[model samples]
Target: MVREKFTHIYARAADRKGGEAELESLLATPLSAQELKGISDDRWLSAFTQKVFQSGMSWKVVRNKWPNFEEVFFGFDIEKMLLMPTEMWERKATDPAIIRHLGKVMTIPENARMIHDAALDHCSFSAMVADWPAEDITGLWRYLKAHGKRLGGNTGPYTLRIMGKDTFILSHDVEAYLRNIGVIDGGRDTRKSLQATQQAFSEWQQESGRPLCQISQIIAFSQGDNRL
Candidate 1:
């Protein structure tokens, strides 16, 4: 369960699937702090809302209607969304362009306010996310779950990944790998399991000098699945 073991597993998988270069191509490079900081708050809000609504629904449906969502939500303008009246969102529940789920529709403004508040406190929502230590990304996940509406479990982590942050996702294959590595006993999403996963990644980062995203992808790929 050391760094070398993980590397060996990745090497074998890469060899089996057309070699190291191909495996590298499958991994996403994380954005730099400066690049992340430059992203607008509206875009951040949009990404958060997309991930929120995509939860427990077909991603294809969300993807197909994203343009409509953007249109109706005013491009997810944080200030404008913050000012949206309750009745306005209620009316949107029956709109055909976007998903008509009332609870998900309602979360848009609430999450927009959360983004706005983060911007108010830190000058920009991107800055707050960029400032979080990548080595302790689980802490950032915890922060989002506590402060942002409907950003619990994988939602926060998935949002951060889509935003190009240097974080690990506990996907099915990744969880299986973690358990196989003795990082967790039951694959439960508990604080202890998260801490163990974090510590293991920190160790692997030190040993391999790779970003968490790539490391996570390698672990997932090592499980014989192409899904990232």
Candidate 2:
């Protein structure tokens, strides 16, 4: 009886539609490593990379200023960054091309030193990527937050999870949809709600002989109504 009830609820929740759009709307536009490498000097890349990290603001603003940031920060070259003194930080802080946050401006050099040290120890950022752990969500979480990454705390974890990179199972949207379908108790604790969904999803996958990817398709199809 409970099985029939859950299957019906799942069918209803899955009918919402436009899951892809919902996924697209939530992603942040961060630059890839390959794009970051095009700059002439690593110093500019270093400074700009850190600048983007400091960008708690809109990604579009950061994306637009990427070239300017490279120009202003000596192409993020680590040596140049290490050479920079307090005067250089003050100069960049006043520049309109970059974020201009004093704290972020100052963090560039320090971050450069850290990156440099890491490079020496780990053989550049590329090497670390090459040696990355499992593609499973939990492994991705450990990798991202590994080695003092400080990945923006909970929101960062949530973002990575939604993008299918890390330990999180249920997304905020999925949880909301579950509530909309009246599967788990809406007023219950979130942890409990999430656990219940995970269990139900697991069982459904087993019974339906569907992988998570196929399940994602079902989610997208069912939730089509969630478009912008």
Candidate 3:
């Protein structure tokens, strides 16, 4: 099966979304490396923690309760988070002030430690993530999965995206497009499938001169019934 070129994809998305300008308006741009580097490690930890809690749950629910999460986690400061004792974690898990899932709540300290360690190695977690090669973003995803708690699958990808890292998310629509284009063959999460996705997106990025995020969104908008 032949794969669709970026031009064909973009045209379909544009037609569905009310032309080029409308499609562009719907697309989100990723941050520059310098911009990503300037963000604090605390923000990185907080963003990933938010994604962890939002996983398999209502994102709006998490958003509504975020201020409380910030307060309970002490603004997600790496040092302060690392200092939290096991007893404190247990207590906080049951606290009505935030989501009470012990498993998700526990991602805080371990992810904090991961970010803290990254900071020591790269001056800041922000610096490391921002510096990661977008061309091989799956590598960073793997790194996060190996190093951080509850950060595998789309969790890591979502956090990187929230932090403005230039990465693509394998969303339902995006995955569907990939399968339609023969870019993905079998199980969606398999290493082979992921690498195929990366390669396809890289080609599209080169062809369209668009960031992976934009290209990913364009593909999603092109394929799904989510039209205007």
Clashes of each: 0, 24, 0
Clashing pairs in 1: none
Candidate 1 lDDT tens digits, 156-207: 8989999988999998888887777688886456889888889988988887
Candidate 2 stretches with Cα past 4 Å from truth are 1-56, 135-150, 154-171, 174-225
Each prediction's Cα lDDT score? Answer: 0.85, 0.51, 0.89
Model 3 global lDDT (CA atoms, 0 to 1): 0.89
Q: Sort by TM-score, best first: what order? A: 3, 1, 2
lDDT of 1: 0.85
TM-score-best of 2 and 3? 3
Model 3 RMSD in angstroms: 1.3
Error of 3 at 71 (Å): 0.7
Highest-TM-score candidate:
3
* TM-score list, all predictions: 0.94, 0.51, 0.96
RMSD, each candidate, Å? 1.9, 7.6, 1.3
Worst 10 residues of 1 by lDDT: 1-10
